[model samples]
Target chain A: MAPILEARHLSKRFRIPSVKRSTVREHVLGMLRPSSTEELVVLDDVSFSVERGETLGIMGRNGCGKSTLLKILSGIYMPDTGEVIARGPITPILELGVGWNPELDAIDNILLLGSVMGMSLKELRQATDEILAFAELERFANMKLQHYSSGMASRLAYAVAFRAVREILILDEIFAVGDAGFRERCESRFRELHSSGHTAIVVSHDPRTIKTFCDRALLVDRGHVVVQGDGLTVADAYTALLTHEPAAAAPTAALPEAVPAS
Target chain B: MADAPTRRHHWGGLVWTLVRTDFKARYHGTVGGFVWALLKPFTMFLVLLGVFSFIFASDPVYKRNLLLGLFLWDFFAEGTKVGIISMHQKGYLLTKTRFPSWIVVVTSASNAVITLAVFTVAIVGFLALTGRTPSPVELVLYLAYLVAALLIVAGISLAGSVLFLRYRDLNQVWDVVTQAGFFVAPIIYPLNILPERFHFYLYLWPPTAIIQFSRAVLVQHDIPTLRAHLMLLGMTAVVFTAGAAIYRRFAPRAVEYI
Candidate 1:
C-alpha cells in the first residue's frame, strides 16, 4: 500500500541568542559585532514514512525531537532540508485546545477547534452532542472554557480530536492527561478506531503502550532515529536509553517475526 | 469554518463573526451597554457643536459644514485608536490560530461603523428637525459619503494595525496622530479658513476628502463631482491594498512578537 505520510531528510534548527541580561553595556559597546550563539539542531536528518492504515509509535527520552518531528509532519513547522508529504487529512494534537478563546463558551470553542482541525462548523454541529457528552460537559457547554478545570480541558480536547474524521492522527504526550479511568477509555477508543483502519502516529516513552499497541516503533535520540523495527525491539532499546544513558545503549536484538514487517 | 467559502462569502463571514464578538465583548456586563455606542458619539457631537458654533458663528463656512466633518473625524479617531490595540487585546486568539487575521482591523472598524450608524440616524433626524430636508440627489450623496468614510477609516485601520504589529512604539504615535488628525483634518474649521498653501495639504489627505464630501452632502446638500468620487475611490483602493500587503507579510510573525 502507498504511504499516507512521508518525511524525507527532515531537519530543523534553532538559533540561540548570545545576549543575556548580565551582559554589561561596556562589554556590549566594546565589540562592533554581536556574538553568534550556538546553533542547536532540534531535528537532524531523519526520515520516516507512515503507510495507510498503520499504527506507528515513537519512543524516546525528553527532547528527542518527537514533538518536532510531529510538527514537521503536521506542517506547523517547515523542515530545513526536506518535506513532509502526506496523502490525507492530518490532525495533530501537539497541544490540545491551542486555539481556545477564553471569553467564548465551549460550544463556540468546539466550532473553532473543529475548524482548526479541518472540520467545518456545519460538521462540528453534527458531532456537537457526542463531543460534549464524551467530555461530560453537556451542562457546561454554554460556560466559558476559562472556567474549565485542567482535566476538563483534557477531556474535551481529546473528545474533539478523536471525533474528527482524521485520516492520520499525531498525538504528542496528550494521552497522559485525565485520570486512569479516562486513560482506559482512551485506550479502548484507540483500539476501536484502529480496527476501523485509521492511521495514528503516537509519541510516548511508555513501554506498555508501544509494545502492546504499536505495530512498529522507532527509537529517537538527539534528533536521530537510532532504531526502527518491531515494537518490542524499539521499546526495549528506548527503555535501555532511559535507564542507562544514550552512550550505554546496546545493539538492539531482532524483534519477533509475528509483528507486521514494516 | 466551512472550508474557505467563496471569496465574497469567506471574507464576509469572517468579518461578521469577528464584528459580532467584538461588539459583544466590548460592552459585555455593563448596564444599557450597546446603547453607549450611540450615546457617546451623540454627546460628543452636541458638546462640540455647542462650543464651536458659538466660537465660529461669524464664519458662514464653519457654521455650515463643521458638524458633519467633526462627526466623521470622531469615527476615524475612535476606529484607529481601537485598531491599534485589537491584536494585543485578542492576543490569545492571534497567537494560536490563523484565520482571516485582517478581521481584527475590520472588527474595530465595524465597531466604529456601528457607532457611526446611530450618528447617521441622528444626522437625518437633526436635519429634519431643523427643516433642512435633503434632495434625492443629496440623499444619494450622503450614501456616497458614508461609503467613502467607511472605506477611509477601514483602510487606515488596516495600515495602523500592521504598523502597530511591526513597531510596538507606534501605539503611542497613533494616539498622537488621532489627536493631530482631529485638528488637522479640518473638523472644527473649514479648509477655506486655512491659508491656500496649507489647503493643498487637505486635498492630499485621504480622510479630508471623506470629510469634505460628507459635509457637502449633509450640510451644503450637494453631490460630489465625478472627479471627487473617483479620487476617494482610488485612494481607498490604494490604502486597502497596501494595508493588506503589509498585514500579510508581517501578521504571521505577529504570533512570535505578540
Candidate 2:
C-alpha cells in the first residue's frame, strides 16, 4: 500500500548569531564589527514514510532532531530543503493547550483551543461536555485557566487533543507531560487508535512506549536514522545507543539507508 | 480523506472564536471591562472638546467635527498599533498550531472594530443631543468610510506586524508616525483651516482622505467630489495590497525570525 505521509530528504538548519544585539543602537554598533554566525543543522537528509493506519515510532536521544523532524512534518517550520507530502488532515499535538488563554474560563479555552486545532465550532460545542467530563474538570469548567494547577491544565489539554484527533496525528513527547494515570489512559487511547488503523508518527524517548505502541520504529542519532525495524529491535538499538555502546555502528557504517523493516 | 482541504477552510469560525477570546482577554482584570475601549478615545474627545470648545464656543460645527474626527483617528491609531504587535504577542499560537498567520492580524484588528462600534454609537448620540440630523445617505457613507478606514489600517497592520517581527524598533517608529498623523490629519482642527499646499499632502495620506471624506459627507452634508472618492479608493487599494504583499513575503519564515 502507498504511504499516507511522505517526508523526502528533509533538512533544517538554524542560524545562531554569536553576538547579541538587543537594541537598534547595538545593532548599528555591531555592523562595524566582523559578523559571525553558526549554523546548527537540526535535521539532515532525513527521509521517512508512514503507510496508512501505521504507527511509526521515532526514537532518539536529546537534541537528536526528533522534535525538529516532527515540527517540519507538521509544517510549523518549513524545512531548509526537501518537502513533506501528507495525504490526509495532519493533527499535530506538538504542544497541548498551546493557544489557551489563561484569562479565559475552561469552557472558553475549549472553544478557542479546539477551533485553533481545526475542529469546527459545531464539533467543539458537541464535545464540550465530553471534554470537561473526560478531564474530570466539569466542576471547574467555568473557572479561569490561571487558577487551574499545571496538571489540570495538561489534563484539560489532553482531553481536548483526544477529542480533536484527526487522520494523522504527530505526537512529540506528549506522554512526557501528563501524570501516570493520564499516561495510562493516553496509552489505552493510542492502543484504540492503533487497532482502528490510524496513522501516526510518535516521537518518544521511552523505549517501552516505542516498543509496545509502534508496529515499526526508527532510531535516530545525530539527525541520521541508524536503525529501522520491528519496534522491539529498534527500541533495543535505542537502548544500546543510550548506554554509550556502539552496538549498531557496523550496520550504520555499512548501510546509510534505513534498515528495512522485517 | 478528501475532506482535508475543507478542514483548512474552517478558519472563519476559528478567527471569530479567537477574536472573542482576545476581546475578553483585553478587558480581563480591568474594572469597567470593555468600557475601557471607549474611554480612551472618548476621554481624548472630552479633553480636546473642552479646550477647543472654550475657544470656539460660538462655533458648534468645529466641536462636532472634532468629535467625529477624534473617533475616526482613535479607530485608525488604536487598530494599527495593536495590530502591528499582535502576531508576536500571540507567539504561543504561532509556534504551536497550524493556523493561518493573517488571522492573527485580523483578530487583533477586530478588537478595535468593537471599540469603534462603541464610539460610533457615541457619535450618533452626540448628533441627537445636539439636535443636528445627519442626512441618511451621508450616514451610510459614514459607515462606508469607517470600513474603508479599517481596511487601510488593517493593511498597514499586516505590513507593520511583519516588519515588527524583524525589527523591534518599529513600535517606537509607529508611535512617532501616529503622533505625527494625529496632528497632520486635522483631527482636532477643521481641514479648511490648513492652507492649499498642505491640502496636497492631506490628499496623499489615506486617513486624511478618510477623515475629510467622512466630515464632508457626515458633518457638512455634502457629497465628496468624484476625484476625492477615487483617491480614497486608490489609497485603500494601494495600502492594502502593499501590506498584503509584505505580509505574504514574510509569513512563511516569520516563525523562525519571531
> Model 2 off-target regions past 4 Å?
A21-26, A250-262, B1-8, B29-31, B56-59, B125-131
Cα shift from native, residue B222, model 1 (Å): 2.4
Report, for all candidates in order, the number of backbone clashes: 0, 0
Runs with alpha carbons beyond 4 Å of true place in candidate 1: A19-38, A245-262, B1-16, B29-31, B59-67, B82-100, B103-108, B125-166, B252-258
Please give, for every candidate in the order listed, the TM-score of chain B alone compared with the true chain B: 0.84, 0.92
* Candidate 1, residue A206: how far the Cα is off, in Å: 2.8
Q: Kindly list the per-residue Cα lDDT of model 1 for residues A53-150, writing each as its tens digit.
A: 89899988787678778866766555667776777777667566555667777887776566555565666789999999877889999998889887
Tens-place lDDT digits, model 1, residues B1-258: 112211222344345456766666677735378788766655776777788888778876565476667667778788778877677665655543334566666777777887777777877888889898777788777777777666666666666676665456566777776777777788777677778888767777776888888788778767778987888788878876777777776664454445
lDDT of 1 at B48: 78
Clashing pairs in 1: none
State which candidate has the highest lDDT: 2
Sorted into a CAPRI-style docking class, model 2 comes out as acceptable
- For each candidate in turn, the TM-score is 0.80, 0.92
- TM-score of candidate 1 relative to the true fold: 0.80
Candidate 2 matches the true fold with a TM-score of 0.92
lDDT by residue for model 2 (A1-262), tens: 6688988888777766678554455677788897666666667778889999999999988987888888778777788788888887777776665556778899988887778778889889999999988788999999998898877887888788777877788888757766677788878887787788788889888888887888899988777788889899998988888786778662332222332211
